[model samples]
Target: MKNVLIVDDERSFLSSVSEGLSAYAAEFNTLTAENGKKAIEILNSTQVDLVVTDLKMPEMDGFELLAYMSRQFPDIPVIVMTAYGTPEIKERVQSMRVSQYLEKPLDFKELVDKIFLELAASSEGYIRGITLPTFLQLVEMERKTCTLKITSKGRIGYLYFNEGQLIGAETETDKGEKAAYEIVCWEDAEIEIESICRRKHRNISTTLGHIIMEGFRLKDEKERAVEKENIIEVGIEETGEVDGEEEIILETLEKEEKMNTLKDILNEFTKLQSVTAVCLVGRDGFLLDSIARTGIDTEMVGAIASSGFGAAESMGRQLGKGELTMSMLEFENGPVMFSPVGENAFLVIVAEKDANLGMIRLKLKKHSHELAAVAAI
Candidate 1:
């Protein structure tokens, strides 16, 4: 069963909508809030799948509620209702990414249909097949307020968020930023979202971006240590002898070869005209590797590129077009390109707006297979 939160200031209208939706009681339960403040209280305690809100209210209006939801409950879809609907108002509502907007005197059947559609499209209360870094970037981007219970390798940890900022984190034996770093670096972590944040006081002062970068560094170090240990153990087991010096040399050569292969491929894009950044990103939005001349957030770039490319591919399918070969988004400063590298990852190129796009496309096509080969490795 699903819960639908309806927020409206007018008592009579609210009652009418609730009564009308009661017919679908078996399908979903309706929760009513007179204003946004009350609505938030319900959200903190209940698992709401959809929100239907009126734009005007005394304490907190629909827009305020929508802003709050965008930060805290972005996965939940919303339907905006307003009596004073205009073109301008519709445009503003669209920008907020509302699932549907119905002017005053809405059709009851239409409203119910929209609700059902939105609910059906939701994530079934589980966020899966997404990387932790990508999910964290989403929380930061949306300014969400929630607590995430993360389980990885049979160990559990908690990350608290208040309005999109990572306020606190903890494991059974650790707390604060140190715990956060460890949790972020965990492999194959599963996340469960809680709408309420229990931590009122901030415990971590480090920025999320810096924390993520540091976490990746720590993860790399830990992986290297494990690899070295495994190599030593294998030698001792197979030959009944351990040569620390030889193992160290072999590890160094292996690491160098792997790094050089990907590095050489990424470096080629840096030599191109007006290129600012080049990256290989996993389909799940993880940044595999990157080369950048500018101070761009490569992680953020990779996350956005993966999401945008997915949307483009979806759009193509809907339009009866073929597979997405390449897609680009042109902004005032530059253009960002996305193309599939292999089944598991893609390539991203960020360049100045006036850069020779034709040449860049040619280079991208020429090198895509090579990058795919490296990714396969």
Candidate 2:
């Protein structure tokens, strides 16, 4: 049901591994490549669920391939195999977040078990190293009838899809459309799939694409509400002292308590009537923290902002400009501003077109130092 790509330069080893893993034909449709270059070609053309690759190859070895995957096909998990795996090599490979690493002369049975574990660990299926949308899209493409159990940030929920149609969903307290939207919007959620769909009635009639889009819309609203609460909590607790760390017992409160205080500054900016959204995006295109009104897609905005900023920064360097200080874009509707928050994060502000840019820039300049402290922590 899943496509797995195997890459090895040695013709004999490649043939043997492919032939041996043929037993899993019921679970995976296997594909093979002689080197990383070919493997990338196959990846570009095929929908691969996983990649099992040998480290040393004639051209574009596994390390290079792995690096390429990290940038382009990050959703696909990889299993790295190599005979010359030393501690140094293992450490470097692990940094890339490969699913598994195996030294040469692999145990065939153990390898099979590992593959199955990576695919789906138990009688109940499992999914990791992939986004929820991608996984749901796969389910729809395959016309799967299954119950997807999800756990995220201590909340648990279930989504029931019968023959690729989402029929029902539930959380501990909510059910139907609301629950479905919430479940689908979860990021980095751990998922388990059961092949049976128990719900007989359909609560959702919208197409899957529409549902996903709406789910994201709802997610952004929920995040803003949470941010509002955090803001209120910290605003009232803000002391006249510029330094709050003196009151925080480092040994007792832990780093998390100290680190969260950084966002407290952003909460103050939202008090401005013109500012509609505030987001902190990491360099890797992840939405770290945000506060925005309904109808805003913070996730999409963050990803786009990260990509756009990265490109702009690269362009500046190519033009022989010094490091970029700030990037701003204005439309007829409103103006958006971006500035480096810290080493690895960027601060984004979405404001009304009529908003005072000078005032906002001044506030950002004054508070940017505070933000940097939070980012450092």
Candidate 3:
């Protein structure tokens, strides 16, 4: 028999759903929680096959609960219930990849059908008790040649390996290295291994270690972006009162002033000879802002720059250096420089090979204080 947990704040709705589902007691058991907190307690103590939850509750809302489940019990399927049912809400839930979504005033028979379907699907072809990263590492250690089929949240991807080296990966929308990055970052995936290697040529040139690290960085960046959007939405909702209008206007103006100051500092850097791009990046590897002469993925550059700078800082510490003020990486085409801007962020400068390094360094030192002042705001 399976156990299905239903979480909502309404006692009357819980009572009705539990009683209505009692007819199928022989097939499965129904569990109820008043809010996400209670649902978490029940989940910690009991074996739950599925979760059906509403989006809003007093303590520990549905979004928080879903995040907890994704980290702890990713293999278990979920069915989301929401009264708002707005496109924005649906899109957010879809991004989380829930098994099913049903609006409030749910049809009893339909809910039951979805529960059974999810339960049955969860039971099939799931390679439980192992993590994707661990399995990949083991395959590499064993020097195995094969292909892996991975499924998570209704998406499927394939990874091809030859003698333990990842050669290629494929998904519906991505291929090669990009696809591999996406697949490696997936959580709670069901994996199937086949003893065959179909792709003879290598499409992914980077080591598996690099791919995994980049995958995690990409995942963290995406999560942070989503969190920032949520915070902005909450801020807007909270400031909707007429009494807060003047305060809101003042705050907006202050923000604009700080932004203009930062942009001015960036513009100074852009005016330097042979300078291709200038970016302000958070210490956590997120791009705060940028100015560039050409099209470039500044976010990716920010993340990589942070990682590289971190390594350089570690090296300096080991070498008994007092502190790391600046670091630079030079390639055949250009040089990239990284320097601390403020306590919370850093500055990056990309310049052509023929650029005057002495003048660039001098300008960087001159404007670093100004940039730091604006960044601190």
lDDT of each: 0.75, 0.71, 0.76
Consecutive 10-residue window with the lowest summed lDDT within model 2 = 89-98
Best by TM-score: 1
Give each model a TM-score. Answer: 0.39, 0.36, 0.36
Candidate 1 error regions (>4 Å):
1-128, 235-377
Over the stretch 1-377, how does candidate 3's per-residue lDDT look in tens digits?
89999999999999999999999999899999999889999999999988998866788766456646655776667777865346643343332223566667888988988787777767884422334654565455345687888888899999888988999999999999999999988877767666688888888999776676578656755764675566556666677754557467557755765687689679867865468999998888888899987687898889999898888888999999967899989999999999988787889999987554654665566567767877776
TM-score for candidate 3, please give it: 0.36
lDDT of 1 by residue, 94-127 (tens): 3222245566788898899878866876755432
Candidate 2 C-alpha lDDT tens digits along 1-377: 78889899888887898899898788888899999899999999998888888766777666456545644676677676755336643443332223455667888886786677667632233333445654565455446687877777899998888988888889998988888888888765666666689788988777665666678656655665676567545644664332465345333233454455555557756755367888888888788788887888989889999988998899999999978889999989898999888788888889886454654665576567657766665
After the best TM-score superposition of candidate 3, give how far the Cα of residue 3 lies from its true spot, in angstroms. Answer: 23
lDDT agreement of model 1 with the native: 0.75
RMSD in Å for model 2: 18.2
Q: Which residue pairs show backbone clashes in model 1?
A: 71-144
